[model samples]
Target: MSTYLPVSGWCYMTNDLMKEIIRVAVEAGERIMKIYEGDIRIEHKEDSSPLTEADRRSHEHIVSELKKITPEIPVLSEESADISWQKRKSWGKYWLVDPLDGTKEFIKKNGEFTVNIALIKENALAAGVVVIPAQKLIYRADINNGAFRRNYDGAETKLTADNNLNTDNLKIVGSRSHQSELMQTFVSNFENYEIVAAGSSLKFCLLAEGKADVYPRFGPTSEWDTAAGQCVLECAGGVVLDNAGNKLQYNTKDSVLNPYFIGMREYNEAVLSWFKALN
Candidate 1:
């Protein structure tokens, strides 16, 4: 049965709705995997980021499913992101999707890519679902509902970020593809920390599952790239703060590019200070 919580005027987050979103993400992942197992043709966008058939197929599947599930809600996908700001600025709630988050990782066949879906209400993350197609795992969260991780065999584990504030032995997750000089400088501030290199939104899931302590993203990312992961991490007792030390928001401006941010299990004055110093 579907249960809903009226979070704001005319906005609701329902358990059944979340389930449907997850299903959409999973089905999209299946489509991507089929292409992943075959000849992967690559293309480039205006920004030169790699694109593949898997990306387009997954985008089509997810967008189609989401529209069928909730015809009223709008959808903004990385593949079909040409929607004008004037058209999107008025959307009180919509689906923010990144059909293929780690195309590079997928091209490398590293099995670290994922399909991301998030619900944005009033420019805030209201719900999210991330499906790791290669690994057959899913992470999900919603407003007022705790986060959870579903395994391949239908097992689910409630996720909670590790509250360990031990900066001496912090496990910082970093991007496998986009590395920056600022990231190295930021890590130099840590006396004893190890880097957990990962691709796509799995970095956020690592924090949500208590597998990693923090994720500092010093490179470029879009709103769709982090919205679903941010919701999962935040719901699991974590936080994703922009350089300005505010929660990362969605669809706030004309450009979809997001500010550099940090995802951590809990608030740490030391980490925040370090980030501020670098910025």
Candidate 2:
């Protein structure tokens, strides 16, 4: 892989490479849409999560294309077989992919599902691409460069999160399909707030585009599910922090399950207090 130094002094992915990553994710979304329009046969994995042909097809296509794009870098997908920690612990960087996020939304035909792909460098997000196939919206970001969103018609716009946001009337984004008691409690603490129920990584995209102020996730999610979105949100002047107010990291342990996290344009003392209380 080639290295490029940005003004941030971070040797990260270049704009051209990020563009290629977005292309791969968009292509995978095209594959997913094909199966989504069909009978939509579903299966269950060992964990009992719903699985569909779209997930498998998208995973295969993403892994193959990423390998061809950078054969030196390893790729990990939600559908891939578990690799031993002994082998993966030493990996400095890799591709983390969730071919089909929001399977529940897909099954419900709500057009909230998405395709996610991220590049992880030493457990930190280096670059990411999130494609909402149903919404015809695409988002991509890298650590050094800023974030951007592209429409289906080929028009692209730069994304900038609102750092100087008003916390009085918070626009909170939550899951449309998945909900939890903890999440309910977190929201209840806020006297003045509006909730936007969305599915998939669109929660993060909402924050990146300044449409939403905060997103608190208390349920289970894999690294692949959040890594891509984290990159986009953070690059857009936002942050995704764990309960401890620390930024989320990937591939530091054997398990892929991620800790509870809050996605926000900027850290709010009131919001962090609520998250800390829950923890």
Candidate 3:
């Protein structure tokens, strides 16, 4: 029920949208910053993780402002918009967003939380934008068009993935705040690699910007969690593939839980075969 548009050049339009979207994301980040610094109360989600007023405020701002920017575009955000299976099945294109990622890190006051916004067209993520509120840094991408990193005070620089992961020279970036056992097992299988920890969607940024080389996730993740970051990484010449060595697709499953996947900087015959064996 959806149509695929040729992935052609559309930099001007995408950048314009990014400018507007950046405005909203930065504003929402400011809103969250205020709560983070003030005497705001932190609650827990139904799953019993820490949820603060900052999360709610940021979510509200992102959803309301994004709707104003693109009214026709449907949104699938972490805090809001739980689309039914029937309804989601009909969405050819949509905005897959997470206003406040790393709420636990936000609660920890480590200043690692980020605001994630992504555009999903067809089954793939078309664009990814990540803003670090405390640092005022931004990571953005529109594949074929380009991907770059910038900060409030810094100039933009192009992002590119490094093909330097081969045994001893390997670098593995794990969840900053949450690492699972399966992930550790998978990483241990590698002959030689240094492991790094990062929070929120920043792990994807590290891979995209060439800071880290590989990311393995054998635990549970949702569609909204990985959509934006995956787009950015893919644009930067990285790949986010499932067990079958295929890129993950959205809205096709009844449950939004993502299967195990690995994000790597470029393709490697050895690693690909290794993962296929793990499959």
Position 278, candidate 3: lDDT: 55
lDDT of each candidate versus the true structure: 0.88, 0.86, 0.79
lDDT of 2 at 208: 93
Each candidate structure's TM-score, on Cα atoms with residue i matched to residue i, is 0.94, 0.93, 0.90
Give candidate 3's error at residue 253 in angstroms.
1.7
Question: In candidate 2, how many Å is residue 137 off?
Answer: 1.3
| lDDT (tens digit, per residue) of candidate 1 on 1-279 | 223223344325676677778878888999999999988999999999999999999999888887777877889999999999999999989999999999999999999999999989999988899999999999999868779999756888899885776899999898655568889899999899888988999999999988888898888899999999998999899999999899899889999999989999988978987987777
Q: lDDT score, residue 236, model 2?
A: 94
lDDT of 1 at 205: 95
lDDT of 3 by residue, 165-240 (tens): 6766778887655557566666767777787888888888899888888877766788888988888888888899
lDDT of 2: 0.86
Model 1 off-target regions past 4 Å?
A: 1-11, 176-179
Could you give candidate 2's per-residue lDDT for residues 1-279 as a string of tens digits?
Answer: 333222122535766667677778888999989888888998999989999999999999888888777777888889994987888899888888999999999999999998999888888998889999988889988877788998867888889995676777888897655557888888888779888988889899999989999998888899999988998999999989998888999999998888888998987777888887998
Better of 1 and 2 by TM-score: 1
